[model samples]
Target: MCSLLRSARALATTVSLAFIFNASSVLADVPQAYALTDIGSLGGYSVPHSIDESGRITGYSYTAGGIRAFSWTQSGGMINLGSLGNDKSMAYDSNEAGTVVGTSIVNGQYRGFIWNAASGMSAVPCPPAATCSARGINSQGVVTGYTQIPGGPYRPFRWSGGELLEYLPTLGGSQGYGAGINADGMVTGVSYTADPLPHAFVSNADTQLTDLGSIDGTTSYGKAINSQGHAVGYGADLGNKSAFFWSPELGMVPLGTLGGPNSYAKGINSADIVVGQSQTRTRATGFVWSAATGMLDLNEMLLGDTGYFITAALDINDAGQITAFGKDSYGRIRTLQLTPVY
Candidate 1:
């Protein structure tokens, strides 16, 4: 009887060890996510805005004298793309083919530009007396953004192969802004309608606009749209803001905050992983959310000082990498990237 009891105990111990080993192996096989790497500046500070599938990063950097657009390569260092004759420029989005779309101050006014390694930067024509800014560019080089008309409201526009077209008509209000564009040329934005309230909207390729109503007791804005037509943004509910993921199938599903009163979903990748920022009881922090993991604070994942505040997660890629900006201990703003831990 004693021998049998000992044998049973040994078997149980072996099984437990095997289970732990398998679990560890599985985690190891998955890429340990959450690596933060600083994309160095051009003799100044760098703020990464977007990353393509090829790992190319585009953003703006402050040089000794002014801000300039930049593209960072995984192999090479930061390459500066000078402005269109002004002292400041910003790169908003880059396509897979390495083409960058952004806005530059030209002749004392804002103008959209498309930049490439071969041709440098060229102005994208906009309606007369309108200030244009490009927000997103897809693989096909189609750029989507909004144009501010002189003495009037802003209107969304789309540019492809050097031809710019006015997007859907505005919501009978004075301001409209396009935030993101997907591969299919679908655009999402926020506009003020007849009710004098801001509402989220989606525009189809053919220029049909559909209003994506806000959450109950809240105002909403759509930030980013994925290829699957999944849109993520934030809505203020009962004086508190919360992130939300929307689709035709599931409608709007609220992604609760990180134990705080406010959260915003800024980017959504093809895998449905969402990246954004959330405020906790003490400080703000970057977060990644998915169906499996819900919401996770990137600062917690790094085991860093949680007292610091993360302001916003600007973008995320399909590889689960994130780019954001936050305030450090000394009150200086810093750009950071977080790679998943598998």
Candidate 2:
């Protein structure tokens, strides 16, 4: 753990810090009010992986038949995205237009698929004979993910058009996965390196790799990047993992855990606000972080009492809305969205 200090006090201690804030000021640093609207599931878990600028959400859920993809909106509610003639399908990310990209099994081969309300789901474009998965899509409809072509290791690629598949270079490693893409076409993800560590890289163009090394650790996985080129992810430090924020201006800065041994930054917005999971003394908890306020437990930021215990915060939008999963009043996991209220 790092020994960095905040507020003139050491921050790297193993003690849980969720209780560190003074009782009176605990909710003062965050919005005074928050509202929750549970995104109902298909009789089972409704996992949300990403949120678009327009507040559309996409991910996977379990119905009576089997697992299926779903898209959610404030007006329309949850709608199941049928499978690709298989029992498995997932919706990882969506673009501004509510188009989703994720993996599906076709003829027993894993394939990438993109879906929109207008056209439904279709196999995505790829190099000949290559197996692929789409992890992210930008507002302009650009897609980024990994491809496993025969005779070649898995490599990240960007697709602007059907035949315009551009492979990105790795950090001299065997595989790379594209995790996030911003409007400028900058892709951020993990690139396994010759040093045997998963180094994060960001590139606007497909030919070059600008690897973001670990923050005093051997592993750096950049999970999300924003329009400002700010990135957030996690890295290992002294047997403990911690979330991190990255940029040309700040480089890599660790966001200490919630008083536990591990933390992961899963989403970042244009304002540089971050959301993810962190280890508390008892279990993993959702967290929101900002440079000005440091890290705070999401549950603590709630405006009123509730039975839910947020476990993982998967994504956040510039509107200050957060997508997450947690135990509901009945102790069952459920997908939830948090909107800030003035």
Q: Cα RMSDs of all predictions?
A: 10.4, 4.9
What shift in Å separates residue 129 of candidate 2 from its native position after superposition?
Answer: 4.8
Report clash pairs, candidate 1.
Answer: 32-341, 32-342, 33-340, 33-341, 33-342, 34-339, 34-340, 34-341
Kindly list the per-residue Cα lDDT of model 2 for residues 1-342, writing each as its tens digit: 233332122143212222332332332234555677788898798889988888988888888988888889999998888876766888989987888999887666778888888999888777657887889999998889988987788888888857667889889888898888988889999999987789988986546778888866688898999988879999876667878888775477778877777889999988777899998878999998865567789988876787888999999988888899998989988888988887
Q: Which stretches of candidate 1 lie above 4 Å from their native place?
A: 1-32, 172-174, 303-311, 327-332
lDDT, candidate 1, equals 0.75
Q: What is the lDDT of residue 92 in candidate 2?
A: 89
Residue 183 shift from truth in candidate 2, angstroms = 0.5
Give per-model TM-scores.
Answer: 0.84, 0.90
